[model samples]
Target: MNIRLNLVATTSLVALLSVSAASAQTMEELIEGAKAEGMLTTIALPHDWCGYGDIIASFKAKYPFLTVNELNPDAGSADELEAIRANKDNKGPQAPDVIDIGLSFGPQSKAEGLVQPYKVSVWDEIPDAVKDADGYYYGAYYGVMSFAVNTDLVDNVPTEWEDLLKPEYAGQVALAGDPRASNQAILGVLSAGMARGAAAGTASGEAGLQFFKELNAAGNFVPVIAKAGTLAQGTTPIMVMWDYNALAARDTLAGNPPVEVTVPTKGTLAGVYVQAISAYAPHPNAAKLWMEHIFSDEGQNGYVKGYCHTARFNTMVAQGKVPQDLLDALPPAEPYEKAYFPTVEEQDANKNAVVSGWDSVVGANVQ
Candidate 1:
């Protein structure tokens, strides 16, 4: 969904839908169905990203009858889709029942028949622009791209995309994931390109590749994927990742190395992550219950606690469902005011350009 709706407009939509009603399944019936199924498998959800660790734990505590199976927490969006495809015929722990993926992947996965349609009880609260008309996939939460710096190692934290090219930042900057396969990195490239004056679609994707090529040639781009541990160890002193992830990392680091998250003045790209049930999910009922739990006020607030703006964030705020403490914890709302939210077509075009050209254009071969 596009951020052009603005919070006020979205709140208005939520108000309009408040009296319209919600999904059909009752919580008790879903719980009973889930308990009979007894298991829920998921993939590519890391404890440190978007406060998912606590969310998962809460789900387990709330539904003690079901076993939560997690797989490859570090896998990227592409890997998640691959897991669904690889396990289409399998019904074991490797088979994921639910998926939290990049926006473009929602439609792509739905098109490939990897995901099935299922709307949550709070469906009415979600913005129409972000959710599928047929309920195939819906946004969960979103965050803008930002720089996570190890303050102990960096005297000057870059606040603009161009600042990363400065000589002082040599061998210090790194992307959070491999651009070829990771949606975050692919979008990271688009953000940088937008800063360099390229338009949003394929042009930005190509421009981003050239930008990274320069960074690599100048010895300022680290080929290794950057994360909390890598940032603390100084392997990647400047990590480019989602603001939520960077903030979570800062909290996780707890001042050991002094972490700082900064949203760049230019190319402030906002990325939305959506959720969907797997078409081949062995425990379909449990998956539906999991969706209901996450889309609930508690679940939306759970994401907010991790610094993500949930799909129902505006609605929850209007309803006074979000805690004051969580509101205070978020990064300044001013930067996000100018954050760009690309449409699915733009994202698909940019993703294709970045993925197909990364090796040929940038040649980093990031591990």
Candidate 2:
């Protein structure tokens, strides 16, 4: 179960043995170290994003000794990397111990030496395709892109990407984050391109940029970064974001103003977020413990409660670990039938295109 022991990369046998010996420490020892550290700093994790509010409470309840220091909850994936880089020389609270970032940022982070390698106890259970072979980072959870509509403000609900461009939807549509930096927003554009029948990769990215350009020109695109509050207030009637985020927002709003979450049948794109420990973490043990906890059965279920599909979903279902009620609580599976998970390489290419082209192509600065 402890794949990290076998995957240690070292030039000398002594170093390998040293890491193996350290990895052999019991969970109790890890707990003790984490308790001694007494704090774990995390960045870009909003409480509602993946039931992290409850999950963080659960961790606090279980490990009373450690305090979870949360940084900017709304920071984008690029912002997360910048935090690591900006604080590499400082071992203060501003320095994040861990990060939850987009899949495309995983390899880039590792390549830039921003993150350290540490596999959870259930390493083998995680799908190999979404995890680093050396354990620098691994998929945490994922959700499909969807439109969260404020029914009170939008009588004609948009069921498809193109439907949002109609004049009736003017001043209504918005993206969840800044496309120039946000993984979610960038991928949303990719989804729109895919919906337009463009092939995935750079082509789709370019297509998505053009679509947004037209959307901006049509006066249908709101420059505001939409969230639950903005949607409920009718500030942004239609938000393009991950299904999990839309679901969470819908739950939080409790039908006040009412909400409709729809995964466009033509352009459903599944985006995965990954987790990693900062290479210069001030609390390495606590960060590792956090990783272990998130990959655990209870932690994974917490994400399910927030509408996200955890990385170990298949394994948990096969082992009958997830609760039946939680599974039943999810939205209808039909809309996600054609959800597409882009390759890391493809995402990297698409992200480059979107980020570079967004300002000039879209001309809408999403706050």
Give lDDT per model, in order: 0.88, 0.88
lDDT string for model 1 (139-246, tens) is 898999999999899999999999999999999999999998889999999999999988888999999999999999999999999999999999999999999999
Residue pairs whose backbone atoms clash in candidate 2: none
- Which residue pairs in candidate 1 collide? none
**TM-score of every prediction relative to native:** 0.94, 0.94
lDDT of 1 at 76: 87
Model 1 residue 364 lDDT score: 91
Q: How accurate locally is residue 266 in candidate 1, as Cα lDDT from 0 to 100?
A: 83
Error of 2 at 85 (Å): 0.3
Instruction: Please give, for residues 11-47, the per-residue lDDT of candidate 2 as tens digits.
Output: 2464345346545767898899998899999998899
Q: Residue 318 error for model 1, in Å?
A: 1.1
Q: Give the TM-score of candidate 1.
A: 0.94
